[model samples]
Target: MPERTHVPVAIIGAGQAGLSVSWYLGRHGIEHLVIEAETPVHAWTDTRWDNFTLVTPNWHCRLPGYSYAGDDPDGFMKRDEVVEWLNGWLDTFNPPLRTHTRVTRLRQGADGGFELTLVSADAEQLLTADDVVIATGGYPLPVIPTFARTLDPAVRQLHSEEYKNADQLPDGAVMVVGTGQSGAQIAEDLHLAGRTVHLAMGKAPRVARFYRGRDCMTWLADMGVYDVGVQEYPGGQAAREKTNHYVTGRDGGRDIDLREFAAQGMHLYGLLEDGRDSRLQFAPTLRESLDSADATYNSICADIDRHIEREGIEAPPATRYEPVWEPDDEPTALDLAAAGVTSIVWAIGYRPDYRWIEASVFDGGGRPMQTRGVTALPGLAFIGLPWMYTWGSGRFHGIDRDAAHIAASIIDRVARGSAGSVVTDGATLATTP
Candidate 1:
């Protein structure tokens, strides 16, 4: 067995969340090691399409001490620019990072720490830490329905991650499933490339790229919508379970209106109900789906309108969106071969996986039970999850608060032992919390 290494803190990911925690801990003279299964590029982000740009504006690209200072706060960062931003943050702190190493298992140690089984190319080693921050993010597993296996062998299927550009796909009509952020955007990407794109709509809502005078994101932020906490979310689980509102940042950012695409001849269908024998079945809810999405779009515009009126701000008149195209009849099925759809892009979202961490911190649904990043387990926390506390928990704009909370929790423990009290901006963490 290789020698066991120990540290005051061990971060289980090298992504922004991990790096943020590392920076905070280091600032206070805390000894920690940031470990990762990959290298300079994160596994999840490395799979983005070549033309992908952030849906949120560059101004929201705030990670710990490294906030965006570029000229284009309103513009979104391209794929390479995003990568550089992360790398730039990494370089800024220069944490004691170990890349190309995966932690196979995490168990509670008998001595009240964490036992991590580290595996790399050369050898398997053991490490221990008093506090462990699981910054691997919430979406750890890509989800493809099992029915995908039953599709025609002639049809090629690619996950959104594997998609680079329209040219990479087989030459033929393309079917894009799951009208979430990835699905809507990918479908647009294909349509723009002159590909005959067919989309399967899901319940995911839509938001306009711009409202009256500014990006809808800016309007929402100013109105304090993104600051809404998970528990305080008015939609509750119904909204939390839904994918984010679909919009795009391509070409200086614009709303992704599937209706507009349909008006332009892109085939639209309801959710993909099943697939087999070279054919696919869809729910006859395409019309309803489109209407619901439009309702959401108008709802957001109304919210912004109310905000402007309440603040008495002299802005342009608000605009309400009406459906540009409505499905006459909800398409119920598609003959993949007949439609000449040689490829299918599965853009469904991911499911979280935390089986590696042997802790009883999850609820019945396997969702972590915690306030912010702090859990019932001492010195154990989860970071970079969607709505971990607020809507921006997973995004760079609000990650610093969560990371600072975890770092503060760890620091309190180091200063006052297991019985220490760590109080953050709004909550108390650590033992006896």
Candidate 2:
């Protein structure tokens, strides 16, 4: 028989999202237990490459109880700095945590609560909680296309999550697919290491590194761009479906546009369509994609200019960006062997995994159907998902707000005795808490 423990709340994951919620719950005098499959901030400590640094500036790290007080607010934090900060925060607050524990299964109990099967070191235990919070993060699994398996056996392929450094790759030209932030940064890293590089262009937006002597992120925050809710912003649903903007934290935080990569001698191509027998097919949308990205960049800068004029803020002279459009001669196909491409890094995005969750909390696309972290289920909630409530919901600086909301909801549910089931009525949640 497994040992059974009951708590008022059970939170899964120990990353930034989970920790933020824990801080809020602690402040609210709620009894909760946090279950982590590995060490705190495992994504940063275990998965990221050795040279990875946060793309967001240090000032953006704003948890509920803890805030970044470092002097270099404009600078980025490296992997080690992030891990160290999380560890220090954990020790200072000391929220009830059980590390090295993984939740194998989660289901509703007979008493309208949650029953979680937790396993650690070959021992299984059952935990019952009045409320359950899933903070497993947005990027649970790397999204790799099926065509990658058709490549030649000699070719080494890896996803961005698996890539470490240039030395870990084969000694030849490298093809990096997907021009998101990871793809751009990895391509630049390989190029600096003296390797021939080819990048596949995607519909990723581009933003300047600095505008009017302020970081683009700082400007976005100041302009309330990050606080824009998904339902409130124009084209919010379509924008949520697209990949993140292309930017880099390297070289003292700089804009990494495709034109910059092409000028740096990196061959650019359209999206990777298919691959078979060492031959790859690309869509003929290279120019279209680059133009779209450039237009997005220009529009953002124009908004900032308007804001500056309206507020009469004294800022440095701004230099407008010039569009760079380089046409690809062969945008349809490429022979991998002839191009000396020995390794391919798929810098594609990630998808959420909800197989372990035995509830109707997800949609057909596996996205949690929640409103500001509160689902139809009175005692169930989610945190740290991209665009969960606002543009910044998944970001470190933005998660605290959602966390507070969910924590308050959980407190209310517990006070109400965690009764009733979750039901939806056409985009409206009817709960009996």
Using TM-score as the measure, the top candidate is: 1
Clashing pairs in 1: none
Clashing pairs in 2: none
Error of 2 at 362 (Å): 1.3
TM-score of 1: 0.95
Candidate 1 segments whose C-alpha is farther than 4 A from its true place? 41-45, 237-239, 417-433
Q: What is the C-alpha RMSD of each candidate to the true structure, in Å?
A: 2.9, 4.6
lDDT of 1 by residue, 1-433 (tens): 7779899899999888888888888877789999999975475467888778899989988876678989999999998899887887777867888999999999999989999999999999999999999988788788899999988999998888889999999899999998888889889889999999999999989999987889999988998887787778887644446678999999999989888898999999988889897889999889888889889899989988899999999998877787777778878889999999999999998887888889999988777888878999998998888888788878877888888888887888888855446566632223344
For lDDT, the strongest prediction is 1
Tell me the lDDT of model 1 at 43.
52
What would the TM-scores of all predictions be? 0.95, 0.93
Per residue, candidate 2 scores C-alpha lDDT tens digits across 313-367 of 8998766778664775747888889999999999988888889999998888988
Model 1, residue 294: distance off in Å is: 0.8
Assess the local accuracy of residue 251 in candidate 2 as a C-alpha lDDT between 0 and 100. 61
